[model samples]
Target: MTPITRSTAQLYETDFVAWTEKTVQLIRAGQFEKNDKSELLLSGKSGNKRF
Candidate 1:
């Protein structure tokens, strides 16, 4: 198989933000888990700490 080159990889990387947003949307829609550690790390409104 042919290797993915730097330019091709860069193109994908440029669209990564949009990809991540779509993934999160899918997770929220119950399609899958978000796998979002940052969201888990944020403090809740009641000041509860989350791991």
Candidate 2:
């Protein structure tokens, strides 16, 4: 069996704005499968807190 190698992206660290926009767009477009976080990583979830 061949092992699959996947490349990782650091969008959240490199460009947070772009990451947020992309995440929002994916949600609005109903592309849930494309979202990195299954729950959308909303505030209070995935360790994200609102300040």
Candidate 3:
């Protein structure tokens, strides 16, 4: 298997502002849960789940 690289991992880590913007967009688009409970339940373990 190919070894993981720092650049590859770093690409997945977005800055705070970018992350916040994307999350807001998703919420507004109705792509994410509307309620806190539903959101928590649907949240992923890591960034991988978000993708």
lDDT of each: 0.72, 0.67, 0.58
Which regions in candidate 2 have their CA more than 4 angstroms from the true location? 1-14, 42-51
Q: How big is the positional error of residue 36 in model 3, measured in Å on the Cα after superposition?
A: 12
Per-residue lDDT, model 1, residue 50, is 60
Q: How displaced is residue 7 in candidate 2, in Å? A: 25
Error of 2 at 23 (Å): 0.5
The Cα error of candidate 1 at residue 27, in Å, is: 0.4
- lDDT for each residue of candidate 2 in 1-51, tens digit (9 for 90 to 100): 865444324543557678778988998999977888644544664687432
Q: How does candidate 3 fare on TM-score?
A: 0.37
The candidate with the higher TM-score, 1 or 2, is 2
**C-alpha lDDT of residue 35 in model 2:** 81
Point out where model 3 deviates above 4 Å: 1-14, 33-51
TM-score of every prediction relative to native? 0.37, 0.47, 0.37
Clashes by residue pair, model 3: none
